[model samples]
Target chain A: MSFPGLPRMTGWRPIATILILAGAVAATARFAFGLGATTNLSDAFPWGLWIGFDFLGIGLAASGFTIVAAVNLFHAKEYEPIVRPAILTAFIGYLLVVLVLIIDLGRPDHFWHPMVMWNPKSVMCEISWCLMLYTTVLSLEFAPIILEKFNIHAPIKWIHAISLPLMIFGVLLSTLHQSSFGSLYLIVPNRLHALWYTPLLPVLFFVSCIASGISMVILESLILSRGGRDYLPTPLRANLAKIIAVTLAVYTVVRLQDLLARGALRELTTLTYYSLAFYAELLIGFVIPFALLLVERIRTSRRGLYAASLMVVVGFAFNRMNTAITGLEQYPTQTYFPSLIEVFIMLGITAVGFSAFSFIVKHFPIFEGAAVAPGLHHTAVAAQANPGFLSPDGGDLEPS
Target chain B: MSQKKAMLIDVTLCVGCNACQGACKEENQLPPSDEKYLSLTAFTALSKYNDLYIRRMCQHCDVPTCVSVCPVGALTKMEAGPVAYDGEKCIGCRYCLQACPFHVPKYEWSSTQPRIQKCKFCASRLAQGRPPACAEACPTGATKFGDRDGLLAEAAGRISAEPTKFVPRIYGRDDVGGTSMLYISPVPFEQLGFDARLGKTPLPMLTMSALSKVPNVLSVGGVMLGGIWWITNRRSEVQAFEATEKKNRPSRHEDNP
Candidate 1:
């Protein structure tokens, strides 16, 4: 049966297909020739695009736990509609992170080593357990949609029963690991540039991730609405923007306070590349967005919200990259820029995530007005509610 | 049987001869190459600082950050003062590379089955009651190996005997909470390309301070979330009961009429 609301076969499909194919080729080459031949990674720079982007992807995915806790644990029923989409985004984001990790690992086959081998002192060990458990939690949280689509009743009840506990546990796990990403760099005070390194790195990372997480949800909601799925209400968008602004404000205060306390604020005044990058990160990523989001008019305006959120997403990516790469350039004589294969692989993984999301949203009960009860199936209910959902030949249901 | 072994390198007597590097390669059975930094093949290397030659290798820290940060316990600091690696236990995460203050661990990027590479302070040689290959090959007694306390005392004596000949400080004495290797140099340690800013506190303490709060966060967060859930659910239950009562009362009035 043809799925309703499946976007017509578009030019983007072929482009995505070609990128995936190229990515596959690049991945194969990476396996055959090894990291030295395919990427700019070396002993001087063991982590590159993969590690940096992993941080960003995971940070953005923080919305999954935030929204889930709001809806399920806190009983904020107004947020229930957005929970599924947030979880889906998180699931896809985590899947991509694991995929990139496997690609980047020296022995991807040994990825399961952390399960049996325990290192309680290791932050990496803790992160590994968190990633594994949280991914499973996300899948469980997302199971209801899949189960409802397939008219599975028994599992749906089980899922609903455990969801509350799952959400609490999930939030705990996300909070620990998200901040641990910053903790990973705490050991390199001498190597990491003073402009970025701080003892408060963990707190900074956690707070910034919350802002970025809310920003990502807002951006995704806007994209979905533009795609003809009005899943998010206007007031909800405004509220989300408000939350983003407040989180960013607090994050800014804490970050600057930490810098001042450490007496590393002087580094920011130096006429050097590190200082320039730091200023750019603070201004474009945090300062501008924070200022824009604080105004009621701008926070309510779709265009203004979009602009601020975009800045946040871009800025957060830069922050993570700087922490992982630029900050470590103090001693390395060989500068690092991701090779073409590395770039293509990253692009390809992104394309795959986007395509998978679109496909899942179309087939599953992702959007509101899409019934999520067992035996109530998506297409039948969607068709009855909106006749446009019944376009059999895959033509545009509404005027574009 | 012996006290924890340590290396005392007197940089003032060290020549630029690369016999130490060659000896390390021979002892480790690593392939020969002109790698400036430590690599999978070259566990120890020499860097020239002006007219002085400084040997670069793992510090084998007393409270090693690498040992603490390794998720699989692949890297461990032995009581014998050598940091040892078990390839079988390594998941190849390379977190040790990021955690090392000295940036000592190296990866085999060219190998499909990669393992972390670094100087283990000649752990095998220590077990056999011999000094490290580099220390054994040093002609000027620039690299000395013995009990860690003994080395520290000897380093202190040299600095006191010729107060103006060498720097008063012993590098790695308390840097990163002391290491198995110590250095006495005529010039400042920073001028010899050392990271002199590394605080005396062990690096692992930084992360442990953050991680120690995990239990508190989990327990407190769990109780808080549970309390919120209970309150919200209770409110909803009360609202539902009141609505049902109002509907029943209206139905009874209509029935009586």
Candidate 2:
């Protein structure tokens, strides 16, 4: 299976290969045996670990829109080098989320039912439409990279012509879908813990995803930089980290204000599973990472930057899981823990995502991307991505 | 559709017989079993609360949370006062199961092609102007079937007639925008495990508060983003043009020399 220049399947690749295979086996068992036999899901707890994984994956993958909006739409030319890599990360991340969603759905066969059935009032309905559209937008957003690599200039020019409206639509779709994930929880007020429930959920979710998406981009930069060149400069990485700090600060203020207004501040002090989990989520995901990133020295250093970004990513995962599972645990019913099959299937999906990303990066021109491509060609590809931004900063980044 | 049908179950008039549960199983075509809890097999169940047997089933909410949350419109609130489910339309996301405040909707977890199982308030029977199986087999007139307004009047009459026998509040009358199934118990409702704090407004409204804003967000957000893109790029373009002009002015003099 080894290509001539590609690294041989060795080290972590074998483990990933096995995980993917195991996941396929688990998924097959799940469909054949039914949810009851192969999974711990019950009538009382319909949504379990997979739903939490979807939230984390989508939130992290938000780098797709964030980076595109930054370089193409917002006229941030200095950050252009890492744009292709960030978009690829987001593209793969969303594909995994959609895959897990299919497996988690009881009727995966009827997944397209949302397309035919219209329910404008339903949050899930809106999310489904947005997810499908954004994924298409992301692929179109990513199309030029593949096209440029293959020297398919005709479609590249055509894709370029529509790129401005594409970016706008991409951002709009991501904004709606990401926030709607929080809206899904609004109807469950009686069941969801007070500490997690609030009308500000949509806003909180949108802001936090921006922070996490940036963190993911930074982390990818660091990972790619290892034993090679730094994909992004230290100052650039630090600048992005500063944005994370600002987003986190805003998230903290809004969340605390909402909790206080709901009189759920008391629940924070009363020691229990819900309170303890909420504290951990707040501390790890928001407070610690925010505090660390605020320090100028920490934001600039490789180790400090890596640690803070990783914490933000981990903390974000914890918060989503706490909201999905821990917050709903105290309601009158049996507590849920994902079955082994469930765990393996999730691990499998993750393994496939990593394997696919590395394989694409190895074969493609993601890093040595538009920055070095023929100046006129890339200027047309990237500069015109946002209309007004195009003729100004967009042309200067290229050698005219 | 005509005045919306309702069931008023007065606990004071009933024994703890489980006849309603048995009748419900037969009517829904579920397998015969003395299941003590609600499941795919049991649409309704009798759970003991001290000496009183509290009946549990779908309340068939007027604006059901399950119907509002379903992505595929698999669930619908019928005009005749039943919350209905069409398994074919369901993608089986299980969002309905998560959103139901009463936890009434059950999933057929044992089936390869599972569907949500719950009381549809016997929609077909109500459509035929016949009482639901459970209400018809109540034996003691404990479960009275009539129009919602008629049920409300009967419940108020029972409460006033024997003040000591029934609680003044009808469990479904104004809770979560009123349910087709109403309960009038001798004891306070909360003591028997009713979610008394569901509030006066329908549960779907809570979701709508966020979902309804989507259109405004989409339109305004689109226009605002487009404006920002144009303005920011224009500023950069001006800055870049100025820098190039300064460099070329010095070069022009050197060329003449």
Candidate 3:
């Protein structure tokens, strides 16, 4: 009755199972009783954690296009090793975003209305189309892996034939949508805090997502190496860190310049909650990471990369939250905080994503030279690849 | 039919009475609540700033940002005057709630199938050639209904005739690109809880500047990417051909023999 790629039932499995069950229950309640009963969302604050996390998920997934452009379009063959994993991450990230949207949407059943019913004037309509199209592109980009697993050489060739065009389209779509996320806020200049509101927000969002993407890739690679999976070469890792540092530096300059030009820097002088939030986002997310990654020794070192990348990710999350939630806290009488059910639902989604990623890595040819033989389940491959695999030290026994 | 209707609310004449509230509730058939802000049941609410009582509702702007941002065309500004809502068309994405500078649109959070709730400017009453329920119920001539241009002229006259008794500006004449609901206050409009910071430009114009460049980006980006693809792929193909040719050739000793 066990699934082919399912991991062994372990201590944490029970916890994940509990979270999934709890999430299902919460979803039922939300659907049955409506948003008022299950969520903290109100008339004043319509969007909350779901929208904010959608921004974060989309931002972190930016590496898919970045890596694809580097390897396929720019002819950076050295980056070929990370391409599959990056695409995989993006595919999962986008799927999770859709899931979050469905949960957050008041009419989840009518999610597809935007496809047939067009509103080109609205930035959200543009976002919906981009998300749909880019997801298709990601699927096309990732199709070769599955074809290779099945030993379907003909379709694999077809996939390779269309890959270049697909990557180009993907890059184009990602560029539009990533920037358009910021464009969504442009209409709310009066509501959004002056510290974050500017005409240059779209450009800032595009650049910051690039920095976040590079940092996320670095962080993921480090985690894989520590888990005894296929690790990226030190040279490639160093190169990525350098890219992160450069993008972060550029982002910092543009952001500060925009603030100064808009006279929004004055808002930062006051020690209010919003100003404090702004400083924390800037100093921790941009300045510290930029400084850390600039040093060769730190950028190359394991601890340094982990620390800097983690900071960038945290900062990116904070930025999205600030834009979507904290900045809109204009009325003192009305405030929003996600309910317990909402929190658990988010956790459940994250758990599912993490488990799915682990399962796919174990099953698929995500890592270099890790292809499984045709007609064999991934569990069989894993057992043959490493005997005595039940022990705690089994992962360590695998070749690095 | 030739003239667009408008509401001119003279705050100087308002006495903070609940008649408008009672009338609105009865006309809308909404449940009773003491909510301080607009909600699903309360299409309009009154907020007090010191002795001044201001009625908060949809401004129904000349260039309504909500109608522009509603991906489903659920909200629209009718030519007659009111900004109308079609519940059948609403997917409830709530972009209207966010895009509204006045923060007027309220959600039906309690309903399984929720719709955005706001003042539609009494489209039904207008169709019947009658004033809105609130305007009809007003004991004082505070809330008046008439042609938009005529109302503007009247508002202008009142402000000029008693400059010392009124603020120098018509609140909605140019705020957020001019709303259909006009206001004239004795003290400053800001003191009556109006957002003085709202710019004169229509909010949708801000997003339009960025969205308009989408076509150019797609075409230019497509060409640039195609060029890179061709150049890079061609070089790799040539290198591969050279490598295969090298392998096919005999070794030096074999060739000499």
Choose the strongest candidate by TM-score.
2
Residues A137-233, candidate 2: write the lDDT tens digits.
8887787778877988898777777777888888999999899899889998898889898888888899999999999999888866773577689
Candidate 3 TM-score over all chains jointly: 0.90
- Model 3 / residue A117 / CA error / Å: 1.5
Q: How does each model score on TM-score?
A: 0.92, 0.94, 0.90
Instruction: Give lDDT: candidate 1, residue A37.
Output: 89
**Residue-level lDDT tens digits of model 2 in B91-206:** 88999899988998888888889899898798999889899999999988888899999999889988999898777888998898889889999899998888877897998898
TM-score of chain B of each: 0.95, 0.96, 0.92
Better of 2 and 3 by lDDT: 2
Give the runs in model 1 whose Cα sits over 4 Å from its true position. A1-10, A331-334, A370-400, B32-37
Q: After superposition, how far is residue A352 of candidate 1 from its true place, in Å?
A: 1.0
The number of the candidate with the highest DockQ is: 2
The residue-by-residue lDDT of candidate 1 on B1-257, one tens digit each, is: 45888999998888878788889999998877666777777788889888888889999999998999998888888989999999888877788887788989988888888888889788888888999998999998999989999999999999999999998999988999999989999999989888778889999988888889889889998989878877876565555545545555677778679
Please tell me which model should have the higher DockQ, number 1 or number 3: 1
Model 1: colliding residue pairs: none
Which one wins by TM-score: 2 or 3? 2
Candidate 3: lDDT of A95?
A: 90
For each candidate, what is the lDDT?
Answer: 0.84, 0.85, 0.83
* lDDT score, candidate 3: 0.83
Give the per-residue lDDT digits (tens) of candidate 3, residues B1-257. 44788899999888878677778888998886655678777778888888888888889899999988988777888988799998877777888988899988988888899888888788999998999998999999889999988999999999999999998889888888888899999899878788778889999999999999899889999999889977876565555545444553455436568
Q: Quote model 2's iRMS.
A: 3.2
